[model samples]
Target: MADATVRPESRWYGPLAATPRHLFVPRWWSPGERDGTWVYELRDGASDPDAWMSCAYDKSLSVITRVGPHHADHAASAAVVPEAWPTSSATLPALVVKLYQHAFLADDSRLLVTCGSGYGTALACRRLGDGRVTSVDVDPYLIQSARDRLAAAGHRPQLEICDVTGALPGVYDRIVSTVSVQGIPASWLAALAPGGRMVTALSGTGLLIVADKTADGGATGQVAPEPAAFMGTRHGDDYPPAPDHADLWATARKADGESVTTGRYPVMRVNSTWDVRSTLELTVPGIEHRMESGADGTRTAYMLHPDGSWARATAPGARQVPTVHQGGPRRLWDELDRIRTWLVIDGDLPVAGAAVRIDPDGTCHLSRSGWSASIGAQ
Candidate 1:
């Protein structure tokens, strides 16, 4: 995992190699389908040592530690939790390194990072010493478990049970979050030392922001050239149930829209494409997407927003244009087509390398090529 995650001479190499990731994650959840319904199948490392080593060291795989409110360690033998969001995980090593790399840590830089299974915090401790690293998580269980595990691994960093968006424990020169946030939290601005850097991804988008604290108690940076995403931070056991979209789904699936037209682009799985998804998320905030492909070569895509807007588009095949139907106060499909058109003409979306200016109040302003969007406190 170390070799796959970082170069031998990289500053993170020694720390990554020295830390035992498997210790941080003794039990994890794996997704599987049971009787046609999604479920999280528990996997105990002690029960299967070989599989444990393989999975724990896999550079690209994130070991889910807690699913909704069901923690794998406390689950019954061969437990399977009904499908729900993952609450915590030992994030993929490569991605963790990427977040660290974005921070540009100095030799003595005080580091504050989001802790889940504590693997990332261990790596930070190994690299910068336990005294220089502080990790926070909202789950009290996670904090206690991680603290015990870190001590067993011969490292003890300050582990706090606190929401990342709330008051932080101390000022730090480098702040990095494995969990995504909707916007730069004002508390983060207040906790960062002058000229400190922050690296985090926006929730629901693949845009990573790397900002340096400014004199005005805000931040200035840019959307990373490469896209990355992480689960959003939660204050409680699980995220508030995803917005109820049952009625909107029905409207998108069955209702003929107020306007119908042949779409200029093929039906796109907007949720799957990072660049396109990021751009649309910036422009149309709370939209949800669903897609299906018929066995007979027909593809259909649906878009629904909390504002009572819905769009359905159907195409004969992957490369064919789609017939679009949109209903509501706004034309959802047209907005998607417009963004696709911009991509076709510009060869890239503006969100990729957009300039990010965050206000002291946590209002994030993103702009590039005359396109600008603001994400304020929710």
Candidate 2:
């Protein structure tokens, strides 16, 4: 009954109905904490199945398995949730079936998938036998738990703890990743068998890209039918802090070189997809955006680039205009204005059609309709 709402009704539903949800989740975690109270704790699933099943079947929710790599084995019945971030989770079933069906897995094809809470891997294994399935995760504990869960219900696929960011254990006919990646790693390209298909979600956007491995260095494909968000692969327990906003702003505002503009758009959110992210990324190139709201009543946004191109826009509260300053060969504001101009002329921009050319050094150029933007590692 729970799996029916997800999609592409699974033969695995009987097995899913058989296994108790409490055994897998044992606990849950929210994005940040619930109030000041941390909800990262294991909720003593040994005593309660209804509560766990309700959470498990929540179509839009992700059930946290481990918080900061803290497993549920040693925690007490009424343990307080940990404040650390979520490391592994059982993704919502809807997304699970979405990615799988996108891969277009053939009856005979071998599949490789990332095992987080293992719920996803189990679904695939159920569709295709254990011999055709392989699941990998960076956490040993997750791999072990998934192994037990799968075996208990009479399934055995390759369960390895290798990181998804590196070389896979074996060549696969198709690879489906539930984790978003910063970029398509060359290792994945190398590990992929000829003519095989791989589906992945890019790191920064909700877009899910489905591509096939080609003879050349690149893969050719299009975005998937639906959107998905996967936690990116982490080499370590935590990520390096993002660049400081205030410091970048002060530096950009102080620099003197290129021309400056007074006003056009008010302080806009950078991540907004409408026309903002495109314009800013186009105009600013490699520069990053920073936003700050101070207790003294000031809102500022800073754009910084490795090329020393920078811009700062500051405004007073909700009303009024933002003062702008920038430096470098390019006037960052002028570039943004140009992109906005393009958006107004044409209703929408093409992302996949955004001409993507990669250099030997791995730098990427995104050019569309005469406007070009470059992306590279920091």
Best candidate according to TM-score: 1
State the lDDT of candidate 2 residue by residue for 47-146, as single tens digits: 6767777787775778876666566665656566647656678887767767777788888888999898777777777778789999998877778888
- Per-residue lDDT of 1-378 in model 1, one digit per residue for the tens? 788888899999998898999999899999999998989999999999999999999999999999999998899999998999898999999989888899998889999999999999999998899999999999999999999999999998999999999999999999999999998899999999999999999998999999999999999999988788888999998889888899889889998989999999888888889988888888888888999899999999999999999999999999999989899988888988899999999999999899999999889999999999999953
Model 2 steric clash pairs: 41-81
Clashing pairs in model 1, backbone N/Cα/C closer than 3 A: none
The true-versus-predicted C-alpha distance at residue 351 of model 1, in Å, is 0.7
Model 2 TM-score, all chains together:
0.75
Best by lDDT: 1
Question: What are the models' TM-scores?
Answer: 0.98, 0.75
| Candidate 1 lowest-lDDT run of ten | 369-378
Residue 245's lDDT within candidate 1 is 90
lDDT of each: 0.92, 0.67
